[model samples]
Structure formats: C-alpha cells, structure tokens
Target: MSSGSPLLADLIEALRCLPGVGGKSAQRMAFHLLERERERGLKLADTLHEAMQRIGHCTRCRNFSEEPMCTICSNASRDRHLLCVVESPVDLAAIEQATGYRGQYFVLMGRLSPLDGLGPQELGLDLLSERLGEGEIEEMILATNPTVEGEATAHYLAQLARAAGIKPTRLAHGVPLGGELEYVDRGTLAHAFGSRLSVD
Candidate 1:
C-alpha cells in the first residue's frame, strides 16, 4: 500500500468508479474534496448515502425516484400522450435539460447486444409491453445513444412500438456522430428534438 493515508486513496479509487472518470480526474477530485471544508465533504457523503438509501425505480416509468412514481410520471399537467424511452436515468436527465419534452420515460438498463448476450428480456422490455397496454401513450421517441448498441435498441423498440400501434421516432441529426445523448450540448439536443424524424 502507498504511504499516504488509506482513506485518501480509497476515496480516489471510489470516485474513479464513476463512468468516464479517469484515474487522474478521480485523483484530482479526491484532492479537491480533501481540501474542501469539512462540512462540504461530509455533506457530499451524506447526500450520496441518503440518495442510495431512498431513491429507487419509479413504478410507472422505471426512472429513478424517491417516491413510487417519478415527478414526470405523477405530474398532473405534463403531457401523458408521448413517451420517451432512453437507455438510462442519466439520459433521461440530459433530455429533460435539453428539451421541453414533458412526457413520460422508460429507462432500459441495457441495449440489444446479441454478442454481449444482452437482449430485450435482459433489458426489461416486457415492462414496456405492459406500459403500452395502459393505452394513453401515442408516440415514443427513441433517444438511445448513437452507438451500435443504441441503434439496435432503437430498432428493437421500433418493432415493439409498431406492435403497440404507437408511432416511433428517432432523434434528428444535430447530435455529433457516434456521440451519446448525455454528451450532446443543450442546443444540439433541442434541435434534434424539434426536427426528429419518424423511424417507422
């Protein structure tokens, strides 16, 4: 083990586990947090612990929520006729920031990857079928990442949307090529949502 305190290195390693956070970034963040006020670090730890303990999948949309239904799903004034299906809660948040898409969402944990052994069943697509049968949804915007797996998942969802008799659409070409929705800027995401093309 390094001579430094185990707590410092442990914090860096833990931070490195976040997606896209490299070792250098994690180390930098760990040092920054260590240099921060005691209350700030403790607050961060407490907030993380509280979120993990209280937050769970929303029953209606499968998005992260502290309650049985997420705010988007339980809102009385939000549009209920359109649904946006994304691959993760992070993507849902990105879209919400980029567009005024006041609709419901379904978070698929994984995309359809045959080689990786990920399929509709593994992605909880059965839940989608049950959701579709509820009868209020009329449109589904597939905002999966622009990767190969994302394309495959979009097509798979298109098939399901067709079966459900709901129109399916894909994001427009504003996002950078091969970029994930989470990485796109707000302007690009808004343009994509405004100019979306039907995938049917």
Candidate 2:
C-alpha cells in the first residue's frame, strides 16, 4: 500500500469508512470499482448521494422516510393501538419481515448510552410520550436489542408506558444476548415475537 498510487490509496481509505470493511477489503473494493465496475460504482455513488439528500426521519416514528410519516405509520389498515418500539429502522424492518405484526412502530434510532451522550432526548422519548398521551395506543412492545443498553432502554420505556396507561411487553429471550434483530433468522424472530412476555 505504501507504493500504491495516491488516488488509489485515497479511494481505499475512503472505502474503509464503511462498516465491517477493513484495509484489505477497502483496497479490493477500490480496485474493483476502478478496474471492472466503474460504471456501476458511479451509479452506486449517485444513488447514495440522492438517498442521503432525500431521505429524512419520519415525523411519527423516527424511521427513515421521504415523507413526514413512514408508510407503516400512515397505513390505516395497521393497528394504531399497538406501538412496537425498536432501536432502529433496520430492527423494525427485520420484525416486519419475520412476523405478522400488523401494529405500528416507533424507531428510537439508538439505545440509551449516557456515557456516549445518548439519552432519552436522543432517542425521542419525549415524542413517544406525547404520542402515548394522545390516548390512541393501548400497548407498547419493547423490541430493543438484547444488550445492556437495550435492556435499560426497554425498562425506561416500560415505565413511560405505564405512566401513559398503556401495557408494556418485551420480546422473548429467544433473541440471544448481544444479538441484533437484523442478524437474527426470520424463524427465530417470529418465535421470539410469538412468545413475548408481558412487562407489567
């Protein structure tokens, strides 16, 4: 890499910004984009730029959407009375794909990490409280990840739900500790949702 061309080195370093991609992977990606897939790489770059410019947080659920409300939040057929709270849009997508959850969702965007400056405000807990106080939602499903921060966030949200006179429940422990919903198998996630326990 020391002997590599400066432009090529820059491309490889830029690719390293991607998650789970290391030096070797970034180098390979850079080489592939330059040598064999220049057209596709350009298209990818353009698409990413467009998406970044257009996509914004959904006003109702905090998920990414082009409109104020996400499709799930605006769909009248969905159960508005049941709100499934998730850590991120990816987690919400996983649950939607795996289970028959016809209810609405609220994406926290992240779990509570006070040391990292992530707290109730960062997670939009105040907006969630406002939504709950509207008296439409009957229950809140805590589907945060199985990490320590996720657990603490779930506990905090459960208390918030109780204050709003809404029942709170959690996903079953079928989702292993430290496992993310996006990586969990569809069958496992379905089972976990089916066997969820009340957090009353």
Candidate 3:
C-alpha cells in the first residue's frame, strides 16, 4: 500500500493493475497523470469507462466487440471453413498482422491452468466443440502461446477437433519455446504459420 495522500495512493495502486507495471512505474504514472497531464488522465478515465461498458466478447469468437460478432467473423471474404484458436485477442491480432491467414478465429482469452482454476470450461472448450460439430470448419489451427499450459490446451483441443472430424494443425516451432505470439516478429509469425504441422 502507498503512504502518500490517500487519493494519490489509490491512483498509484490502480495503475499497478496494468500489465508490466510495478510499484515505481505505477507511482511515476500516477504522478505524471496528476501533475503533467490531468486532462489526458480524465479523458483516459472516461474512455476506459465507456469502452468497458460498451465493448463485450464476440458471441462466436470471444474477441472484443461492440457488436455481437467481430469484424473478422462477420466478413464474408474470410474462410468460414478454417478456424484458428489463440490464447488471447492479442495473439489473434499478431497473427493477422503478420500472416495471410484469412480464416475466422476463436480467442480462448486464456489457456488451461489448473492451478489458476483455468480449465476447459474456463476456456469455453464446450463452445469450441459445438462449433467443430457444426461441420462448417474443415480445419482448426492451434495458435496458442508456446508455453506448457498453451501446449496442453492445444493438445486437448486437438483431440476435440479430431473427434468432431475436423483436421487440427499446430503452429510450427519457428515460434521459440515458451514465446508469446504478441512479442514474435512478423517474419517468425509468417514462417510459423506457413510451416504449421498436423496435430491429428
């Protein structure tokens, strides 16, 4: 807990909720916002509130959306027969920016982590299974992060895909072990997508 003015301390602690923010960083951000950019801070607060209130998960893909479906899922040009599973919306964006993949996506939003109380139900595997059973998807690509939990999630989804008669493929190892897709370079992402291997 912070020891300064109660409001300033609360602001610093709130900033710490952001990813990669530590105590000092949060303190710096709070001071910067309060002293140097009060208007920006107010705008930021308003935008955050508005966005949180309006944006929600896409009904089909679970990506952030203001509507029921995301733009990719709603686009007719994308291949409805192909679906890529990713650990988060950030990973999906990375792959889209780096590769020529025109398939729809399923953002798990998180991988299986039993210790964290994350499991099939948490990842909405049941929803994915329902989609697979619909016969619209011919191929399912596992693009989960290259972590242990990600690998386990991919393998589990692979079994579900195969049981539903859809081919499941895994991104190639061009992505370093335990590397996150959001941090991977475009070239590496493209190479990994191009060289994806069958997991069936």
- lDDT per prediction? 0.87, 0.92, 0.92
As a TM-score, model 1 comes out at: 0.75
List model 1 lDDT by residue over 33-140, tens digit each.
Answer: 778766798998899999989999888878889999988888998888898999999898899898888888899876888798988788888889998878889999
The local distance difference test score of model 1 is 0.87
Tens-place lDDT per residue, model 2, 55-131, is 99999999999898889889999998899999998899899899999999999999999999999999999999999
What clash pairs does model 3 have?
A: none
Q: If the candidates were sorted by their TM-score against the true structure, best first, what order would they fall in?
A: 2, 1, 3
Q: lDDT per residue, candidate 3, 94-148, as tens digits?
A: 9999999998999998999999999889888888888998899999999998778
Each candidate structure's count of clashing pairs = 0, 0, 0
Worst 10 residues of 3 by lDDT: 1-10
Which scores better on lDDT, 1 or 3?
3
Q: Candidate 2: where are CA atoms >4 Å away?
A: 2-6, 174-200
The true-versus-predicted C-alpha distance at residue 47 of model 1, in Å, is: 0.8
lDDT of 3: 0.92
TM-score of each: 0.75, 0.79, 0.75
